[model samples]
Target: MNHRMIDRNREEGHARLYRDYFSDAPTYTETHFRRRFRMRRSLFLRIEEAVTTHDNYFTQRTDVVGVRGLSSLQKVTAALRMLSYGTAGDAVDDYVRIGESTTIESLKRFVKAIVEVYGDEYLRRTNDEDVSRLLRENEQRGFPEMLGSIDCMHWKWKNCQTGWQDRSHLFEDLAESHGPKVRYTVNGYEYNMGYYLADGIYPSRTTFVKTISKPQGKKRKYFAYAQESVRKDVEEHLEFYNLDLQ
Candidate 1:
């Protein structure tokens, strides 16, 4: 069997990629970069630096045949394009000059590297400092002790296995069973719990501050409108909750 050799001029790919996005005078504007990459260029560069430091696979290397491999920028750009656009791995070959198999490998390694490097800070439980910051921010928005707004995404599990249940960890931290006790005041009435703004579908709980479904008076109507407007913040940010229920 003869080996199929295809010349993918990786150096030109790197040069083109740098000129299009990373050069001192890039072809694309910051707005275009953010729209395509789903993040600011600075944030993407920070992530690139972090992932390169954490994993050697992202570092461009010289092969045994004295050929230079793909740059870290090329590998990461291919991976991010797939992730941000939900496009096929082969779709990046023309732009990033990465083969389909290499693109898939880069995605797997890039995701694993990100989780390993940043999961501790980004995926951990909200700490006291986090709570304080949230409280302050929410208070400025007319919610004195609001931790955050609670919302969920619903996706059909096609071909899901039998006897499996959807278990949510969103309420793990706010569960009355093991949740921390705290005190706050609303309208001069002291309460023993912080609350999250939520919709009517959520079960009534001390931790939930759902809007009124039907308002009878002007004051109640205004209150509902104000609560709903502020609640959109969580939906926009796609924030996470780690509370538990009793």
Candidate 2:
């Protein structure tokens, strides 16, 4: 009874070894590969080359007994599927032909390789050119010298310290806003410049422009419409960027 059980387990483990799921044939075309991996074939191949070149762990090799390991494409595709869909490691076994533990290890190694290779170029600090470009783009959107939008989001920290829980005083500089505070002076009359649009939770600072709850005059209505529209554009851009990454 135990001998048959061991044989069955061994057969099942090798079932995915010869499946042509990752092949470039009619069954699994390049188009299907790109859709599932969320990247073009060329880009995937480029990344594979970079990863295998940078780290020997990702390189395909044969064991002492002549058993061949997974290819670079197989490992990268498994990792990319998990990253794209946030699925369990075992979920990719059928298509990528990689075991759950191996898939998870591939993901860890893939991410490490990406950060090591492209972190500096993509994660560099903004320089003068970047600042100028931001200001110019915002100026075209009726906001001169504006850097970017500012907002806070809450993140749940499971193991947060008690001392870090009640640190509202850290945001003391962002005190509640008062209505119609003068930001800058143009000739004699006061002019508000370099302001950001925020939600009602923020205090009425001259730097922050909140939507008016009730507007009686046409000018106020127009201002509210324009402000909300521009603010929506910023929100939509962020959402688009996130979706593209996913």
Candidate 3:
């Protein structure tokens, strides 16, 4: 093998990589950048500032020969694209000017910075004020004393047991087996607590109000219709809130 030829080939490879993947400005408009990164340019700049301040890994550096390396913008853009689309690191190389290994490192540093900077504000448990506000808002929805609704969903567990486990542990702290201890009256019957609307598969505790499978009397039928309607409204409201947050 010719050593000089091998060296020439290697240098040519590096030149092509720099030209094709890391030469100039990203080939995307602001709108496209927002769509791909899931944030506006202004927001991206703010986040870039935070990330760069928190970790020097995101900051741009000069190469050994005084050439400028990748900027913080390119590294963060690569990382955000990977996260927003759940794509592989190399998938963004063509547009973001990032290699797969560097993209992965950017992702790790970005995540760590986010956790360090915003975790305290966003991850805290609900406090007394939150609970009070929830109770007040829920009372206006016609279900007086109601706290919140609970439901279980089945996820595909590739290696776990297929059978569902009871989630009674969630309510273990509550004194009453039926539900919240707030008392309210309905149809001349006094109840000692608010109840969650659940499916029949849930236990027959007072905390859960399941729909009637066989409604014989007019009262039972009316109750079943009303309960299901209220449940639907709550679910729709929650869906809207989630969309707004996104």
| Winner by TM-score | 1
Error of 3 at 8 (Å): 16
Report the lDDT tens digits of candidate 3 across residue range 10-73.
Answer: 2343344345333565445666655545555556667788899999987778769775667787
Residue-level error in angstroms, candidate 3, position 195: 14
Q: Write the per-residue lDDT of candidate 2 for residues 34-77, one digit (tens) a residue.
A: 56665555566678888999988888787797767677777777
Q: Which candidate wins on lDDT? A: 1
Model 1 C-alpha lDDT per residue in residues 185-223, reported as the tens digit of each score: 767988876688877766657888889889879999998
Q: Which scores better on lDDT, 2 or 3?
A: 3
Worst 10 residues of 3 by lDDT: 158-167
The 10-residue segment of model 1 with minimum total lDDT is: 155-164
Every model's TM-score:
0.62, 0.49, 0.47
- Per-model C-alpha RMSD: 7.3, 9.4, 10.5
RMSD of candidate 2 to the truth, in angstroms, is 9.4
What order do you get sorting by TM-score, best first?
1, 2, 3
After superposition, the stretches of candidate 2 with alpha carbons farther than 4 Å from their true spots are: 1-34, 131-246
lDDT of each: 0.75, 0.60, 0.62
